[model samples]
Target: MTRPIFAATPVNTPVHGLSAFGDLKYPAGFKQFDYANPDAPKGGIIRLQPGDWLFNQNTNTFNTLNTFVRTGSAPPRMELCFDSLMSGSLDEPDTIYGLVAETVTISEDRNSFTFRLRPEARFHDGSRITAEDVAFSYDLLKRDGHPTFQLILAEMAAAEALSDGEFRLTFSGQQSERTILAASTFPILSKKELATKKFDSGHLQPFLGSGPYRVGRFSAGRFIEYERVEDDWARNLPFRNGLYLFDIIRIDSFSDRNAAFEAFKKGETEWRGEFTASVWATEYDFPAVLDGRVIKREFPEDQRPSFYCKAINQRRERFRDLRVRQAIARCFDFEWINRNIFYGLYRRNQSPFESSPYKAEGLPGPEELAILEPLRGKIPEEAFGEAVVQPTTDGTGNDRRNLREAARLMHEAGWTLKDGFLHNEKGERFTVEYLVNDETFLRISPGFIRNLRSIGIDATIRQVDPSQYQLRLIDFEFDMIDVAFSLGATPTRDTLMQFFHSSTANLPGSNNYVGMADEAVDQLVDIAARADNRQDFTIAMKCLDRVLRARLDWIPNWGSANRRVAFWDKFGFREPKPDYGFPVEALWWYDEEKAKAIGK
Candidate 1:
């Protein structure tokens, strides 16, 4: 006899997936995501140096195993060991399908959501995953997880277990309608394992998980390996099919990018996502690329807007004036940096919402005007005019016109050049420090610093270790920093709040790197969150984008249109990666035949 998968059927009709503003791509009972290769072979190891990371993860090094908290550096891919109620799709913008959950029932008012857990879900310790575990996970993350989690879970009124198989989450009315999309994807911790442990501790202890992989061999700061669970309960699930196929996925940490690239060259690591443009153009001529052992390729980036920029800390009194911030932004010469330093491979970034439909362009439309009309005199006056665009330079390292404008702005802000330094009315020198973990900035930052110094401002670059850099960022102790973020195609309210909300401005470990605490931006975020339809949401977001660009809180940098990657030739991956993400760790698999042919 076949065992039942669910307890009692939900009282309301259950859905297999949730969408923010569109129909579900896969209906109930769908076999697998279209991008997944269900028939792909699953074995062998894939070693990589992760170029991107999320939350508390540091790509260079780690000290703690608990990535859910904000105290210490956590290794990349720590989330692979934990299972969530729902998992997202790479092909869709803002949608999720059940993973640990078999189905979900939405209340009529939509503030409440009930999830029916699959009876087969089990933790690594062979303990049954009950609804109580899910409730515990949410409560723990809300109470003591990273500040990012605390900010996102602020709208969740409560999480409760109705039965062994049923978990319900109720949200406060202040929450956006689409907040559930993010809430459902949080990693569900095993209450039995983490309940007794310090949830806020930065120790390197292993936490119980119910996902397809578990932490295997790990050295504190050098490398961590995840061994695939041979008897994973969700191996055959529709949402999990053909994913997490590697038997062993290993991540190695290096103190710098060049060191990681050298390791990649020595075959210590098999894959690397190239971040340095000059290195991509000049390097890779090593033996691996000379033959065909290594393949250099560019993959399409997801549809989300690429947010790469330098954030000026508004919390500093020296940077409080709008004119001061605008003057500082004018010092960065993107055209010269792109041509000389980056090998002309990057495009100048203009808006934080770059490459997306919400990027404000030309003048505000009538709908956007309708959203901005009420906020007149409250927001920047430039918001109603043509959208703010970065000034164009002549591609020379020194652009006289832009520098002249910058000097005028500085003078208006009461910063005058005296004794070879820009000093404000308070007799304090205008000093700015660019803090970075990677030494690559040592080469790229000199030109920008020269421009800042040319305008009589004292600007310097400081490179610290990755751990120290992360700690400084967490404590909001930097004058300026270079960073990038991958945003969702359909951004949720919580996502925007983590980056630009007033509530998170002073919250430790929050993503509000610019320390933005604008009342107008907060109201605009609320408008965007309340938008029920896609068209209305787009208008509100565009309105917000216009205002944010004019504020110059973040000095937009440069970004590439494609993902530059180099990997060994022994692996096989499906063509045409997903539109929303390309999780090579989960989607690509080892090919024994190809490995033999390539002599790997």
Candidate 2:
């Protein structure tokens, strides 16, 4: 038989790190990660708004401190309060170094892993973090945690605490080779703290933590602060040196994006990641930016595949037809919006896997064709030809050529203009309501809505509060919604399954926003996940991208390659950030001399 793809140590040997490709960057007993500065100072506050978030996190406002469940909205960066079995490296793609567990040993069959915990590991309450806590955390998450966690841990068969300092996890044979990599990064909660409380309840009280920071003070929907732990247990660990340097990390919440921008302009918040192109180009002329007190610059985005688009709910019967979806996509004029609204700072997005090698390009190569040949009868014929691209429209507000084509396609789909509105043969009007949480979409979506009206479709925008908007999204209550997401540097099978698999199409709170349920796409995802090497993985993913683009369920939008940010000049950081992620609050520290120079 062929050797397993993940080649670990022999049954008795333990290693300091684990990688997907059986290679580790840092050797045993390494001093620190290459991206970390060993002498970075560790004090001062950094005030900012949330730039990115994970499961159950809402950037606008929060009602609960428990972010790991699906019952309520929570603030970002709550992950700082918990420790995991292993932590990931910033510069590498799929390697993880030990954090709470000192070393790990793999079984010969590759179905079991044993992690030995450090003897000195302790929780914030001065209690020892034992193997039992790790076991309890996994079992609880697999049963009562968020839906995302349930989907990821579906293949885990058992979690056993071999001893007070040793833990073992066994997986079913059906799991992918990289499932352990995702499992190792889950936060280990305290069994003693959560055993008496409800795991799924929405509560403002924080859990006991062992990571670098703890929840300090917070209101229900306004602001929350994380105070750095002075006696952090893993402060000097090889994987954690020169990180979490801020004495206090504060995150404020505002219902409106423009209000948050104003806060940054007045120096109430120290850092602001500018997302609106019009504001970035014209509104930086404030006195602070005119002087040297505030620095406005662009930082390179993370090197990963991202999806930014409008997802039409295929669960609704009106959007189930491919021709209708294609016609709706043709109505969007990215060229006009880019020039007139975005100030020519964005590029038209063409593929779901944007900025990655997995995106299907010209015609399918020999390797990709080998994967697509068997699925020919199931997928679209266009998927076998040159990759599908979005239509290029004239910069004129009304592109007669594309608009005429859109009208023809809608007519062919059994939707004809009658009494100034497109109606199907069954007398149902073609209406699309764009659901949003704030007034931000009012400025950018008018052109698209106007184009839709010109084609005799009833297009409208509906604005709701942040909480209600989130509730509607969870219930799949909207006709169309805009979603932007960044996948992991090396996405595994389980990660993609949550976004495209049929099993999660109707699952509540799942990320399959378009309600995709394609058998050929599911087969391609499985083949890609089972790849033993990077070359084979790339081929399978390119084939899958071709099929997804041909379906036209998600209409491509615009994207930028860099992050537009403005910050006060009181922080010091090393240049040339890491490739995979940019956690500014953890990497940058206060410069006292610069703060004095700025009269702060």
Candidate 3:
């Protein structure tokens, strides 16, 4: 019973007048915007510029921000907020479909779970949501949250609050239904408001929340308000009944994104899309999208489990050679970065479950080699017997058979080529480096480091600063880096054992920063975290995606067909689901005189 492999495909329908800024003019019936406008007004002030703020509050420290009491630029002090007991499919991924836990109940010996807590939930000081505030916010996020928040409550083992609304928890091994849907990042706080507010981080207040907004005013690096609670006991759940609907919700913080898209094109901001693509194909064509006051949409989401590749550093001993990591994964060209820097709108991801449904592609058939022939020969028999190929750049420009199969796998890994460079057998030379952080990898790693110095392999690209690029990625001190690993919307196996586990190597900012261990990827991530159904979690996630595409530990990039927003047509929105984003608290307020008599 192992058929799975489905590769996805089917998309192609955007050719009647194009325009994601490239052949404009095609508007007619995209009008639907009265985001609750009692005469178009509610309370103004919306500035936001977030590209990183929240300098430190020790959200109970996880992997960085070493000890802090206060360092804010505001926003990150919500008293309690989490509700969604089931609403998915706007594409699905910002998981948690069950709001204030109204039903969880797992235990068919998958090791306990329970939940059941919606007795008219409360807490904005109206106090109610019990189960001992969800077992005291899981024993204070397993003692000061974020170390992957106790790897999603590491086999929990006893959380019991069986009364006051019943909770349970229990797990010592095998429970993970993505750890009970990551108990929606557990935020139920207020065990008597942190025992009378001495909860440090410069004790900012606002400790009471049954969510749907409440805080109502803060001013740390300027601006923080939030109000709309209107008696919100998990407001009829289902992806939050009509969500926050702003009765006032400000955030305002800017570091820059072209001065917050010029304060969202001078309206001071009431939502702005993630611009840049030269302000989404040339700054909002003023007169607000030809006089509608601004509305530039581009939905088509489902691809963001981010991975724009080029990582390597396999404990960097010249990338610990699997033929120089399959010749640097066949020297990147990703169809020339999807037709010149992602305008052709990306694709190509090859595994670590790209676009999910447990990606496996080809080879391993025979019921996936009967669950990968019990890790026969312990993994790489061309990853369970071949078929993962795909590197063909024939755009006529040249990737010449992936640069002659990356110079015949770096001259059969002993690396020789000489005068043309490659070296090794102690002549040394091989080189590599490549660490970048932008200017599009200083323009695609200098044409892929001039095709790895035309096959004699030298590579280079450095560029730092993002705190010296998080101190050379927490001192694994580079040899290849180009990050991006977002994934989490049931892309489990504990998110591929927290990124290629070797016990999350040197845990620092741990997402197993590429130190990849493998006992057949730790027994197919422990049989896809105790499978038990969904056809044994698609046969242990297609045998951990055929041993992570035969351990080429990352060389998969591109995916993000579109999210590209640009708000302000007054607000109101819809079409967006997958890793959800602009629900901007259920927008509302776009009846500009009935959208100027329907020319919106």
What TM-score would every model get versus the actual structure?
0.97, 0.98, 0.32
TM-score computed on alpha carbons, candidate 3: 0.32
Write one digit per residue (lDDT tens) for candidate 1, span 341-394.
899999988888887888998998788888888989988899999999888788
lDDT by residue (93-209, candidate 2, tens digit) is: 788878899998888788888999998888998899999999999999999888788888898999999999999989987887788888888999999999788886477999988
Q: lDDT per prediction?
A: 0.87, 0.88, 0.57
Q: How many residue pairs clash per model?
A: 0, 0, 19
Sorted by lDDT (best first), the order is 2, 1, 3
Off by over 4 Å in 2: 1-3, 8-12
- Worst ten in a row by lDDT for model 3: 13-22
Alpha-carbon error at 101 in model 3, in Å? 17
- After superposition on all CA atoms, how large is the RMSD of candidate 3? 22.4
TM-score, candidate number 2: 0.98
Q: Please name the candidate that would achieve the greatest TM-score relative to the true structure.
A: 2
Residue 391 of model 2, lDDT score: 91
